[model samples]
Target: MRTAVTAMKIPPSLLSWRSDSWRSDGRTDSFSNEYFKRRNQLKRLLFACLVRWFMTAVLVMGTYLVLWRYSRKAAMISNKKKEFNTLIIALSIALGLNIASSLKHLDLANFEPLQRPKADYILQSENFSCLFQLGYVTRRHWVRVYVLFWVLVNVASQIAVASLGLTYNINSADTIAVTTPGVVAIPDMSNIQTGKVLSSNSQAISALRYTANNYGLVALAYGFGDIDEMPKAGSLFNSDGDLMYCDLNSCYYVFYEATPDNLDYYQSVATNRSISTQATCQSWRVLKGGDGTERTITIDNANKTQLTIPALNGGSQTTFMVDPDRGSGPTWGHVLAFEASATDPWFYNCNVTIGPVTNVQNPLQDVGVNVTSLAASAIALQGYGASTIGVSFNSTRHFQFQSYPAESYYGGPQGGNNTGMGQLMASFAVGVVAITAQVNTNVNATGLLPLKGIELDITSWTYVHIILILTVGLQLLLAVIAAVIASKVTIRDHSCVGLAAALQPLLWKLDNSGSSRTTCEKRIFERLGDGVKVSYIKGRSGLYYIKADE
Candidate 1:
């Protein structure tokens, strides 16, 4: 038992406190070493924390400021007011959450290779499992790509909503009015024919010859012409004579008197040369009797009556005759005659007389009035005196007519009570109140126009929005994980083993004994078995070294 105790006892040289010569070795106090290591770790942790805070502040506040300034600048340049407050708030929240999560993932200890597995080892381990392969590479790039895609989709949706314009229906009334003027009168012809005389007798003789030949009395008058003869007097005859003649149809007696005054008086009223001589003879008051013939007579009195004689040439003659009962009647009676031929019969004479002249004023009148339209089912016009006019506006054409509203004259669609008088009265009332003389109306008119309203079709984008939201969340998560991975120090293969395994060789005396070595190896194998394949291989130095298989 004494021998076993001695073998297990620690040597004095190994323990510095138990050795008098410990000062000769250049080693610090164990407690002080531990204190310094702890202090260094604390400093490192604080530095890491400060860096994270700085990065978070820059990312959050800097991004917000940049985005705010950019939005304002864009609004000014485009001349449009855009609201980004909500978007800014949402972005800030997202960034804050990201920062918080990133900070949460940060571990100061992960920065030390002695404290954790290196990046290569982690990557190797991740290769062994498909689940961890994503974490092997940074996911920040993919998250940024996805965020861009989401932003594009959101912008497209907004544009689509803006493109949907306006729509609606309209209805109304329109009116029009028109006016025009009335009839005209005629002028006189007697004063124009009153100044010529010697030429009158010649005209009378020529007229006598024409009348005698026209009546077929020339042959008979010349054949029996020798009752009495007198001295030469006028151009009507070579000498004064009285001639009597008879024809199968009638008998005529001719006498000529060619005084200048008498010729002048005859010329004033004669229509032609044939009547001039006969007119002069009658005015002398020498001949009297019915003569059973018709002749034109002229009277100068203002109270004279007018008469019309039918002519052989399909025309009539107008002449004035004095009122026989008037006190200022002419002293002479004029008679001129002509018998109708058997081939042309004459009926009772037609008497035409001039009536007293009247004075008149023109009233408003509408002629060729037209109303047209496609929208109106009916159009109507009404005027004073209960006159109404209507048009069936069914045809896209003009409705035209002459209408006298003041005279109670109406045209167009008739019979309906609302159409004629009633409509006219309504129009008149409107005009009176409106201080206008014309009124127009439309019936059953319908109009159309545009209105403001909108509807969004988001059914197809429902899943897309959801996907975008989830993608944003995923991006944040990926960013945090990437931050953590970046902050971590690269780990070595040896660091994967726990402290117990590392201190095993130091705490136990395994190198001198086969059993102890076997025990240490077995312990190592047991602890690392789940993560890696452990094997022993002989090296060139003729010693066995442990190896980890991937």
Candidate 2:
């Protein structure tokens, strides 16, 4: 047995300990300097295993916080997933730095240190699989096992972090409703008479003519099947923003009130916006030339009729109209034409149903007010009181309406180079609220705006935010616990040079035993069969070393 041990070249450092403890070799001065340099092992390990891990966790969680908010516009990466991926990669690298610190952390894995496999300790530091092997190998000891488990926990959190992309993929919401930092336009009737918008030379008249061509009116169908179910959709961009919509139900109308932005203050802050709505809606459809005579079609003023694309060109036209019921103040009237031609009829007489909307704070519910002559004269206004009556709103809501904005009139993506209120509200409705290079020839029309909605009612969203919060939150919790439990004591360096230095006494006593002089360490370890058992020693002045006994 002794001869075989000798042939195996087992170092004296592993076989037995010196009686003096301090070797009588010529390396005392070198050993003393090395031991003194490694004194703050505990502090270093604390920072490595705890401070670093927590910092990484915070960074990861912070990234998720940004992603949860759809309103957060990123200046750097436009794509959501690309931005998240970049952040994950950068923070993960920061997390990886802790691995080096953990190599020496095993020395202080527990308060009362005991003998373990030295080769296993050193091997597990750099190799991932080796760490698991050490974990299983040290399963009998609670502290070491948990320490290993802590590292695994960190790894698990990172995996969870990696799965964030997948989570977004699987759980992304199709549509999101939020009150955003912007504006929606509803007409202010008070300005109409004072502004002389009806005058032939008025800016509104010119804008109206341009609107005829730029946003040509299309006919829509209003199902009489359920007028009682007034459209909950609140936007006019797709359908009329008027109270007169659907089969024929009376309405309690409220609208977002905003003035025409001069394109300078295009993005209106929703929090500061004033809300107003009309009590009822009255729609008028006027047809000219198709049936050989000018005919004014009046549908149920209490309900909206769905329209189809009006027949075009063939010398005929169908127009949708808006008659802002003249209140005590001067509210204007609107004529939206299906075809833009100088000869096409304009209604000075009241026979057509005007797609009218007004501002009312409170409107009596389930009551119908049919104002066919919304803007006839002050004499008519005196007969009924203000065209739009004011009421107190106990509870009002901003409902949703699904509408696509009028397409580029010029017919190309390289649209106008100025954001009209018309297209500005349209862009963000798709996400990425922006008013980019939108332009038009008519300066009056370009400056005027259509109603743009700000996010107020968030009924749904693009991604499942609650799930993401819970998952990332859970990841943070796990990471924090692991960091606390892994308060390691690092005695030796994790680098190959530091590891070699720690085992110097043993290495120095061994010689190449294989016939091949250039044999690798792998061959030598294989010949040794089971690896060496190791124990630690506290020498003079808190110096530490790995030693073994036969």
Candidate 3:
């Protein structure tokens, strides 16, 4: 009937795809989007992990450097290179292990997003079955626990080692021996005369027999005043077998019995015109005595305050004569004597030429006895350089004189006296004695002496070794844990639909099959109906329709 034909129009979106291929194409696109999204998420997670690991590495490295510096300095101070090296090695291994464990993701190539999948997907997908596995979490927790334990143990070990190594006890003993000389002063002895007159010249004279006016006589001489004053000369002994010249100046004159040969030797040095012409005094060796010689006397004219007298019989006897009147004549009255035997030869002496004399009590009693009180002139012998005598003295006792060489007149031969110059003159009045003698002495004495030292009861090596072993064990555990976590975490191209939304599609498919859906599916479909859009193609028709829609 001649009707005009009209062209039918189709939607551009629907015209491009066949109804059967639409579902496949949509699924591929969705899967691709989900895969890219998951990949991007995993990349972000990996970046964060890398950043965290890098910071941890920096912190660990900084801590290690600080510890290394401290250990190096301590090693230098204590000279413990081995211990320092051991600690450094252990720390290095521990740091290495930590770094290695942190890099586990890179080693395993596991860049997984930690997103939770739908319960239905979990139940249906074999790949996502292990999402909630406790193995990974347990391993991570245990690794942390072990690392914490290791750190605590290491600290405790270090403290224990340090405490053990640093503390110690010391037992000590020391010996100190001292010897001092005695002093005797006889003042105001100018009028006393106990010997025969030897000279009438004003020049000072030596007391030796050879220096006396009588060249033919073989006898010791003693006196005060100038040679021109006819000073007396005397023998040391008298008719009653007692000391003949008991008068102060005469009795103290140092005497050495001389043979004819000794006399000739003295004359040779004394008569030298060059020596006699000098304005300043000079020293001359005048006498020596013994079987061959047991004593030697040297007279120093310039230094009249001291004499060099050596006891050839292995004795420490020194004597010095003092001039109290401050006259231009020879030294006359006071005598400072030092006596030390060879068997106990310990001597110390100090001479104080100027300054006020002060009292000195026992200061080193624990080390030795302070025998400074034995001297008659205690003040002069109290300070440094003063000899320490082993003998004790009282201020009330009369001065005791001990002679060497066994003089039959004074007493018998005395042996082994523990007295030095200071002790002998320790009791003297401070200012009364013009010249002071220095005495130095020591003996075989024993006492406790304090000394400083370090004892290593526990070594750093022990602690270092323990830490190293524990660190290695923990590091191994960390490696295993890292592997487990790396294996357990998984990434998959999951649909973007949520659990309830995904259930709607299953309900529709089940309903299309002419089967009643389960109660759980019905509830899921009802709850997610408004939130989901489902697409499908009409059978035997070219039109696409939404099976379910929000």
Local distance difference test, candidate 1: 0.25
lDDT of each: 0.25, 0.32, 0.28
- Give the candidate number with the greatest lDDT: 2
Per-residue C-alpha lDDT of model 2 across residues 1-550, encoded as one tens digit per residue: 2253332333333102221123324365344223432324334434445554465456556655644553342112124445555765675455445433332233323323333453445346545555556565564576456556656655664555455444433122212222222334433222112122223423342232222222221111211122343333322222222322222111122222223445443321111111111212222332333221323322222453322322223223222322233221222222222222224322111221222333233231111222122221111111111112133331111110111212422121211122222122111111100000011111111112323222212233333355345444554454444344432222444345445656554443343334234356665445433444554455556445655333
In model 2, the runs with Cα more than 4 Å from the true position are 1-40, 47-58, 61-65, 68-118, 121-123, 135-151, 163-490, 512-519, 526-532, 539-543
* Superior candidate under TM-score, 1 versus 2: 2
For model 3, the superposed segments whose C-alpha errors exceed 4 Å read 1-46, 54-296, 299-550
Measured against the true structure, the TM-scores of the candidates, in listed sequence, are: 0.18, 0.39, 0.25
lDDT of 2: 0.32
Candidate 1 lDDT, 402-422, residue by residue in tens: 122222222222222222322
Misplaced by over 4 Å in model 1 are 1-40, 74-550
Per-structure clash totals for the candidates = 8, 40, 54
- Superposed Cα RMSD, model 1: 38.9
Please state the error at residue 508 of candidate 2 in Å.
Answer: 3.4
Superior candidate under lDDT, 1 versus 3? 3
- Say which candidate scores most in TM-score: 2
